[model samples]
Target: MRQTLLATSLLGLSAIMPAYAADYVIDTEKAHAFIDFRIQHLGYSWMSGRFNDFSGTFSYDAEKPEASKVDVDIDVTSVDTNFAERDKHLRERFLETDKFPKASFKSTSFKQQDDGSLMVTGDFTLHGVTHELSFPVQKVGEGADPWGGYRAGFVGETEFTISDYGINVDMLGPSSQVVYLTLSIEGIKQ
Candidate 1:
């Protein structure tokens, strides 16, 4: 009878224990992740570009999603707009890649919405400046891959003015003040 009572108590304690969050590495090796951006060009058209190198990781807890976290590092010199001259100008004049060759984002909070989406807030550091940014992230899916690896994917979008990160916006014209960023991340469970 004593053994039965002890087992029952242990089981009850286990039920109240918090669930462990799963850690995942962003799948940059397989090119399953991207950090893309778009900005207005002379108020005439949208200029699109992407950073070719970046890495990140995330921790997710299905039972307590609010406790999830993410951290990412980007190679600012890897910005590619498809035009060599323009890309050079961006790296030299605007981003000043030689002085600030890296950018990063560290999530501060994650709030789950009623629609099953998440509102992610983080400190984004770019060009040596740090700012608080928030964006909504939608989970694309999560499942096991054919390679026997589990994966999860999400897409998030946010926009900010170039001046916010210490980049000059006057040269690009008023319409190009803000740059829109899109992050498509697929992570493999570790």
Candidate 2:
């Protein structure tokens, strides 16, 4: 009878071990978070640029959406347009990165659509302001790397008016209110 009780205890322990050890943390060294933002330059075209430094982490269970979570922080001062003067003005005056410093996102929930895409709802904090933002995320795919880490690709796109966030490109005079933003992220699971 004692032997049987010991066997049952061992079985329970083994079952719980897998559950307890199921967390997967993103490998930041191999991850990429990039953003492309464009503002209207004039009545004719737009001025485009991207952020150079941003970092984040994600927790995901390959099987379920409820088990997935994401947290991302972006350095606003890292704004780069490949031109020094424009970058400085944008950071110091327009964005005022000294005061705001960073932007962040934390996902609240995800829903898998019938087309194999995802509807991700989250809170985005920018320039000391917080807003509920939702966007469509598509799983570009997943694959194995030669180094043994797994690679997953996702593409997300969203647009917001700069004025909505208290950004005034109106100083540019003829620019529009909408600023388009696109995010392309590559995450490596370690």
Best by lDDT: 1
- Can you write out model 2's per-residue Cα lDDT over 1-190, one digit (the tens) per residue? 9999999999988977744212334444544557778877665777889877787766555567555667778889988887899999999878889899899888998888888777787998887888888888876767787878776767778877676677665767545667677777767775
CA lDDT of each prediction against the hidden true structure = 0.95, 0.74
Residue 139 lDDT in candidate 1? 86
Q: Tell me the RMSD of model 2 versus the true structure.
A: 3.5
Highest TM-score scorer: 1
Instruction: Find the 10 residues in a row with the least total lDDT in model 2.
Output: 19-28
Question: How close is each model in CA RMSD to the real structure?
Answer: 1.5, 3.5
**Worst window of 10 by summed lDDT in candidate 1:** 164-173
After superposition, the stretches of candidate 2 with alpha carbons farther than 4 Å from their true spots are 1-31, 173-175
Instruction: Please write out the lDDT profile of model 1 over residues 1-190, one tens digit for every residue.
Output: 9999999999999999888889999999989999999999989999999999999999887779898899999999999999999999999999999999999999999999999999999999999999999999998989899999999999999999999899974876899999999999999999
